[model samples]
Target: MRVLLCTFIQIVMWCGYSIVLFLSHHDHNFYETILMLMFGYFNFLVAQRLNINKSVALNMTISLTLIYVTGKMIIG
Candidate 1:
């Protein structure tokens, strides 16, 4: 049951990320999108390796992304 719940949450996160990515497609270049995807995948792998909860890891990733975006906007 816990595994199923985690999987569901991860799926939701992925879907949300995909929609956001799609919406902002014009804002990012292909290389930037690829790099973001790579970073997300790497973050998931590290979280799994560390035995961290999927939801927590995904939340952290979202937080980090928001932080990055916020910083970029502020700096610009």
Candidate 2:
């Protein structure tokens, strides 16, 4: 049940990222870099606390992507 919840959250985050990425397709590396950093650090922190490597990695990836998309929008 916990795994299912985590998976569901990942799926939602993924869908959100896809939509943002698609809409901000023209954004360059600056946005991407910021996003990656944000995700890496955020995920690292969360994972460290929860002791869940996979979720941490997954969340960071999704978080970075969503952040990048959002950054692109702000700067677009």
Candidate 3:
């Protein structure tokens, strides 16, 4: 149940991040990158608390970020 919840939270955060990127026209300044990294770190912490594997959590974070970025680019 916790794993499912964490997955859902990550997905929602990805979507929100994608929307922000799209709105900003993908300029992606340093601050935005920092913010994204912070978010990823938060996700990692959540996954740790939920007893998820570190590698799997990291993989999911990278994959979701890539997926959202690709989607934003393709849609724009």
Ranking, TM-score, top scorer first: 3, 1, 2
- Which of the numbered candidates is closest to the native, going by highest TM-score? 3
Alpha-carbon RMSD of each model: 10.7, 7.8, 2.8
Report the number of clashing residue pairs per model.
0, 0, 0
TM per candidate comes to 0.55, 0.45, 0.69
Poorest lDDT segment (10 consecutive residues) of candidate 2: 1-10
Alpha carbon lDDT of each predicted model: 0.62, 0.58, 0.76
- Which of candidates 1 and 2 is the stronger one according to lDDT? 1
lDDT of 2: 0.58
Best-performing candidate as measured by lDDT:
3
Report how far residue 68 has shifted in candidate 2, in Å. 16
Candidate 3 per-residue lDDT, tens place, 1-76, comes to 7667878888887777667766886575796788778777887777787888888777877777777667866987
In model 1, residue pairs whose N, Cα or C atoms come closer than 3 Å (at least 3 residues apart or on different chains), thus clashing, are none
63 Cα displacement, candidate 3 (Å)? 1.1
Candidate 2 per-residue lDDT, tens place, 1-76, comes to 4444544454465456557667887999799567646545554454444545775556655665576568667977
Candidate 3 achieves a global lDDT of 0.76
